[model samples]
Target: MSILITGATGTIGSLITARLAEAGAEVKALVRQAGKRDFPAGVTEVIADLTDVPSMRAALSSVRTLFLLNAVTPDEVTQALITLNLAREAGIERIVYLSVIHADKFTNVPHFTGKHTVERMIESHGVPATILRPAYFMQNELMVQQTLRDYGVYPMPIGSKGVSMIDARDIADVAVAELLRRDRAPTALDRVTLELVGPQALTGAAVAQAWSLALSREVAYGGDDVAAFEGQMASFGPSWLAYDMRLMMAGIQAFGMQAEDGTVERLQAILGRPLRTYDDFVREAAGQA
Candidate 1:
C-alpha cells in the first residue's frame, strides 16, 4: 500500500513514516524542499507544499492512502481544505487526519477551530477518513526541559483541571495501524473518530511533582498565567501563534483535555498494549538534562 504522508518531516509524521517503512509498506513523504532525503532506503520523498495545489496534486499521484497532518501555521486551514479537495479529486482511498482532542470545545483557539472546520468539511463531503483526536502531547514538555532544569518550575499553566497527555509515539502507532487497516481493505471503510489518550489524567501540580521526582529536586507548578505564557511564546515565535497558543492554554485551564470513560481502554485496545506514561517521559527528559 502506497501512502502519502503530509507534514512528513514533523515529529509524529516522521515516526509514522519510519514505522511504516519498517513494516515493509511503500511510503512516500511529502516535504516542502528537495534537499530532504531522510527517509529509509526504499521510501520515496515528494517535494510538495501544502499551499501549492499543483505540487500537492503531483504528490497525491498514485497514492492510495494519505496521512494528513498540518502544522500549526497561519495558513493551516487553507492548506488543509485545499489538500483535502485535491485528495478527494485524486480518489484517495484512505485519509488519517491528526486533530487535537476537544477541538470542538476549544472554540477560541485558532488551530482548534481550524481543525474543527476541516472535520466538518470531511463529514459533509463524505470523505472516507479516520480522525485521530489526540490529547496534549507529553513530548511538548521537551521544549521546556531547560526551563524546568534551570528555574525548578513547570511553566505550562495547565491549571488544576486534569489533562490526559498522550505520547506522540502512541499517536503515530494508532495512525499507522489505521492507515494499514484502511489501505489493505477490499473497500473503503466508514468514517471513524478515535479519541487517543494516555493511561493517566494529570494536573499541573501532578506534572510538577512528576518532574520533581524525576529530577530529585523540588519543582513548583507555575500558576495559570496565560499572559506570561503568551509573552514567553512570543519571545521566540510569531505573536499570532503565541496568542493562538495562549487561547489554547486558556481553554485547557477552563475545560481540561481529559478523556471520557473507556477512552484510554479503547486506545490501549487499539495498540494492544499499555500507553506510554508522563512519568517515564519526565524521567527520560530529566536524565537527558
Candidate 2:
C-alpha cells in the first residue's frame, strides 16, 4: 500500500513517515524541495507543494492513502481545500488529517477554524478520512529553550488553565495506526475523529515546575499575557501568525483547552500503551538539551 504524507518533514508528519517506513509500508514523502531535506532512507520523496495543484495531483498518483498535514499559514484553508479536492480526484483511498484539539469548538481561532474547514471539506467531498485532533504538543516547549536557559521561564500563555497536552510522538503513533488500519480492514476507521491528548491535565505553573525538576534549575511561568506572547512570537514569525496565536492563547486562558472526557483511554486503546507523561517528555527534552 502506497501512503503519501504531506508536511512530511514537519513535527508530526516526519515521525509518521519514519514509523510507516519502519513498518515496511510503502511510504512517499511529499516535500516542497527534493534533496533539500533528508527523509527516512527507505521512503520515497515526491517534490510537490500543497498550493501547486498540478504538482500535488501528480504526487497523489498511485498513493492509496494520504496523511494531510498543512502548516499554519495565511493560506492554510485554501491549500488544504486544494489538496483535499486533488486527493479526491486522484482516488486516494484514505486521508488522515492532523488537526488541533477542540478544533470544532474553537471556531474563533484562525488555525483551529482553518482545520475545521478542511475537516468539513474532507467529509463533504466524500473522502474516506480520519481526523486526529491532538492537544497542545509537549514538544512545543522546545521553542523556549533560550528563555528557559537564560531567564528560567516557561513563556507560553497557557495561563492557570490546565491543558491535556500530548507528545507529538503519540499523535504520530495514532496516525500510523489509522493509516495502516486501512490495509488490515478497508472499512475500519473511516470518517472517524480521534482526540489525542496526554494522561494528565497540566497548568502552566505545573509545566514550569516540571521543567525545573527535569533541568535542576528554576523555571517560572511567564503568566497569561497575550500582548507579551504576541510580541515574542512576532519577533520570529509574521505579525499575522502572532495575532492568530494570541487569539488561540486568549481562548485557552478564557475557556481552558482541556481534553474531552475519555480521551486518554481512547488513545491508550489505539496505542496499546500508556500515554507519555509531561514529566517523561521533560526528561527526554532535558537529555536532548
Candidate 3:
C-alpha cells in the first residue's frame, strides 16, 4: 500500500510529498484536481476532495500510512469527522496528522476546534497515530512579503510571549521522517504527541530585528487592535479561512500560541540535524524572491 498524502497542494503537505517522492517512497497524493499544480517526479496524484467520504475512502483503499493536513472549508466539521471515519474504515495502520499547538484548548477558533475534534476521532479509532502539534507557521512571513519589502519590516501581535515559530518545511521534514521509516522515528506513535518547533523563540520585536538584519531594512510591527485585525480579515478575506486566522491571532496577541517547552532539543532529537531557524527561513524566502 502506498502512502496517501491529503492536502498535497499545501505548503507542508507539498514539502512532505516532495521529500517522500525524492526519497523514492511509494506515495499517492489525494488531490481534487489533476494537472492543476506541479508535484515531484514519480508521485501518484489521486483526485479526491475531503468533503466526499466515498472518494476519500477510495483513495485510501491501499494506503497504510496517512498524512492528514487540515483543509479549510465552509463545512470543516463535516469534512474532518468524515475523513477520520473513512481512514478507520480503510484500515489505515498509521496516521500522522498536523495540528496547531493549542488545539485542545482553543474554542474561539472553529478550525482548531475541528482539528481537536479530528484528533479525538483518530484516538477513538484503533489506528496507530502520531499527532504533530506545531506552533504558528513561519511561512506566514510570505503574506507580508510586500509589506516587508516596501517598509523593510515585519509586524504581528506577538508581545512578551515568546513562541517557538516553526518552519512549516521543518514540520514537513519531521512528518516525512516520522512516517517514511516508521520504526526508526521516536517509536511513540500511539501514546504520544510531538510538538514541532524551530531553533529559537523570539518576540515580535525580536523577529522584526531579525528581518531587518536579513533584508537590510528596518522592519516594523504594527498591531494591538485585535478588533481591527479581525474586522479587516472578516470583510476582505477568504470566507472560510478568515475567522480561523483571526481567532488564532487573537490567541497569539493574548499569549495563547506560545510553546510550553523549548523546541530545539526535541526537534534535534528527531531530525538528527539542526532544525531550520528563522534566519535560515528568511534567507530561503529571500532566495526565492
- The best candidate in terms of lDDT: 1
lDDT tens digits, residue span 1-289, model 1: 4999988888999999999999889999998886575788788989889998888888898899999999999999999999999999999969999988999999989999999999999999999999999999999999998888899999999997889998999999999999999999989999999988888889999999999999888999999999999999999999999999999999999998988898888888889999999999888878877
Query: For residues 193-233, what per-residue lDDT tens digits would candidate 2 score against the true structure?
Result: 88888988888899899989988999999999999999989
RMSD of 1: 0.9
Task: Rate residue 271 of model 1 by lDDT.
Answer: 93
Off by over 4 Å in 3: 183-189
| Best-performing candidate as measured by TM-score | 1
* True-vs-predicted CA distance for residue 135, candidate 2, Å: 0.8
As for model 3, its CA RMSD to the true structure in angstroms is: 2.5
Pairing residues by index, what is the TM-score of model 3? 0.91
Which residue pairs overlap in candidate 1's backbone? Answer: none
Per-prediction TM-score, please?
0.98, 0.96, 0.91
Scored against the true structure, residue 259 in model 1 reaches a CA lDDT of: 81
Model 2 score (lDDT): 0.87
Q: List the residue pairs that clash in candidate 3.
A: 152-219, 153-219
Clashes of 3: 2
When 2 and 3 are scored with lDDT, the better candidate is 2
